[model samples]
Target: MEIRPIVTDEDHAAALREIDRLWGVEPGTPGGDRFDVLVTLVQAYEERRWPMPKLDPVEHIIGHMDLTGRTQADLAKLLGSRSRASEVLNRKRALTVEMIHKLQSEWGIPAELLIRPYKLDAA
Candidate 1:
C-alpha cells in the first residue's frame, strides 16, 4: 500500500476518496491500516492549511446565551453587575480576569475562549 503526506488540496481530496473506499474495511486488515494512516494525514493537512479560527469572545458569549437560553440578567448575575454585563456585551469594556474566572467557573464558559483579545471602545 503506497501512502504519502497530504500536502496540497488535490492530495487531501485523494485521501478522502481513499477513506470513503476504506470506510467499511474490517480492522486489523491492510485496508483498515491504510484508512487509519490516510485519516491522520488528512487531519494534519487540514489543521495546517485551514485551521478553525478562534471564536470571537463577545460573539461566543452571545452565542452561548442564545444556545443556553440565558439572558442579560443571567450574565449580570455571573459578572456581579448589570452594567458590567451590558458593557461587556456591547464591546465597550474589557472583561477583567476575575470576570473571566467567574464566567468559566459558574457558567462553564471556557476560559480560553473568554480570554481572547478583544477591542474596547475608545474613550
Candidate 2:
C-alpha cells in the first residue's frame, strides 16, 4: 500500500477514486486495509481543508421533521402554538432552554446541535 498523508485536494480526490475501485474488498485483505487507511486520510484532509459549518438548529429541526414525517402543527404542539412554531421555524424568535430540553427529550435530537447559535431573520 502506497499510503501517504493526503495533503491537497488533488490527493484527496485521487484517494477517493482509488477507494471506489477498492470498495467491497474483503476486510482482512490487502486492498481492504489500504481502503480503510485512505478513507481515514481523505476524511482528515477534507476536514482540515474544508471544515463544515456548525449545525444550524433550524436545519436540524427541519431535517428531523422530514425524517419522521412530522409537520409544523406537530412542532406547534411540542412548542406551544402554530404561530410560535412559525416564529421559531421562520427564525423570527429565539429558542428557549425549555424548548431545547423538550425537543431533546421528545424528538431524541442532541441538545448540543439544537443549542448552537444560528442566524435569525431581521425584524
Candidate 3:
C-alpha cells in the first residue's frame, strides 16, 4: 500500500490505475482502505485541476425557462412588466427583493441562486 499524494498528471494517472486494480475489494481491508484514500485524493486533485464555474443567475433563469417552456412574455407577467423582465434578462438591472420573491413563489426558482451577485452592463 504505497499511496502518494496526487501532485502531477502522471501521479494522478498512476493512482487511477491502482484504484482500478483495487476496485471491488472488500471494505475495511487493506486494498479497500487504499482504494478509499486514492479515490479521495483523485477527487481533490481533479477539483483543483478542473474547477467548475459558478452558475450565473440570469443563465439559470433562462435555462429554467427553456426547460419549463416558459418565455420572456411569461417572465414579464411574473415580474409585472415586460420592460423590467427585459432589463433583468439583459443585465441592465439587478433583481430586486420583490422580484426575487415573485420568482421564488411563482416560478420555483431558488432565491439563493437569484441572490448571487452578477455582472451588469456598463452604462
Candidate 4:
C-alpha cells in the first residue's frame, strides 16, 4: 500500500475511499493498519478544513427542546419553575452553575454548551 500525506482535497477523498474499503479489516493485518492510517489522515484533513463552533447555551437548549418535543414546563421540572424556565429560555436570566450541572447530568447536554452566553428576544 502506498501511503502519502493527506495534503490536498483529492488526497483526502482518496484516503476516505480507502478507509471505507478497508473498514472492518482484522486487527494486526495490513488492511487494518491501512485503515488506521487513513482514518488519522482524514481526521487531520477535516480538522484543518472544518472547525466546530462552540454552540450557544440557550440555542442549544432550545434545539434540544424542539428535538425532544419538550416545552417550557418540561424544562421547568428539570430547571425549576415554569417562569424560571421561560426566563432562562427568553435570555432574561443566565444559567447558574448548578443549573448547568443539572442540565449536563439530566439532559445529557454538554455543560460548556449550556454555559455560553446567548441573547433572548424580549417577550
Candidate 5:
C-alpha cells in the first residue's frame, strides 16, 4: 500500500476518495487496513487544517434547544425549575458548578463546554 502524510488539499481529497471507495470493508482484510490508515491520515490533516473552535456554553445550549425543538420550559425542566431556567437563559445568572454538572448529566452536554466563562446580564 502506498501511504503518505496528507499535506495538501489534493492529498486530503485523495484520502477521502479512498475512504469512500473502501467504506464498509470488513476488518482483518487488506481493504480494511487501507481504510483504517487513510482515515487516520485524513483525521490528522483535518485537525490541523480545520481546528474546531470551542462553542460558547449558552450558545451551545441554545443551539441544542433549537435543534431538538425543545422549548424554554423543556430547558427549565432539564435545569430543575422554570425560574432557574429563565435566569440562565436570560443571562441573569452564570452557570454554577452544580448547574454545569446537572446540564452535563441530564442533557448529555459536555461539562467542560458548560464551564467556560460567559456573560450574564443583571436580572
Candidate 6:
C-alpha cells in the first residue's frame, strides 16, 4: 500500500495489514522505515478515534490488591484504620493527599493515577 495518512477504518486496516507484512523488518532499511511511519500513523488515528477512559483510583487499588494477593485488611493496615480503608475502597470517602502519598511511597501506585478525580457514593 502507498504511504498515506490513516483517516478512515479502511485506511487503518490497510496500515495494519502493511504493518503485519513489515513485521520483523530489519531496522535502518526502507521497509523498516515504512513500518515505523505506518505504526505511528495507526496509533495516532486509533487514539484520536477511540480514546481510553480515565483509570478509576479505587478500582485501581482493588486491582492492585487482587494482583498482589493483598486484601482489605492489608489496605486497612496500610491506611492505619479499617473504617478509613473501607470508606476509601467503598467510594464513601475520597482519597486525601496524604493517602495518595502513602500509597505511592509504600505500594508504588503512581500518584498521577491516584490524584485523578473519581465519583464517590452520594450516601
Cα-based lDDT at residue 70, candidate 5:
83
Predicted candidate 2 versus true structure: per-residue lDDT over 9-95, tens digit per residue: 778888988999999999979888898899999989988999987669989999999999999999999998999899999999989
Question: At residue 14, what lDDT does model 5 achieve?
Answer: 86
lDDT of 4 by residue, 15-108 (tens): 8888888988997898888788888878988988886776689889999889888888989999879889988988888899988998899888
Clashing residue pairs in candidate 6, if any? none
What is the Å distance of residue 70 in model 2 from its true position? 3.7
Sorting all predicted structures by lDDT, with the top scorer first, yields: 6, 3, 2, 1, 5, 4
Q: Which ranges in model 2 have alpha carbons more than 4 Å from their true place?
A: 26-31, 66-69, 118-123
lDDT of 5: 0.87
- By summed lDDT, the worst window of 10 consecutive residues in model 2 runs over 1-10
lDDT of 1 by residue, 1-123 (tens): 369887789888888998998898988798888888888898999999999876778888998999999999999989888999999999898988998898788888899998889887775
Q: Model 3 lDDT vs. the true structure?
A: 0.92
Error of 3 at 78 (Å): 0.3
lDDT by residue (1-123, candidate 3, tens digit) is 478888899999999999999889999998888899999999999999999788888998998999999999999999989999999999999999999999899999999999999999975
User: How high is each candidate's TM-score?
Assistant: 0.65, 0.71, 0.59, 0.75, 0.82, 0.71
Better model by lDDT: candidate 3 vs candidate 5: 3
Q: Between candidates 1 and 5, which one is better according to TM-score? A: 5
Best by lDDT: 6
Model 6, span 37-113: residue lDDT tens: 99999999999999987679998899889998999999999999999999999999999999999999999899898
Better of 4 and 6 by TM-score: 4
Tell me the tens digit of each residue's lDDT in model 5 across 1-123. 378999999989888988998999998798888899999999999999999886778888898889878899998887789998988888887888888887788878888888889877865
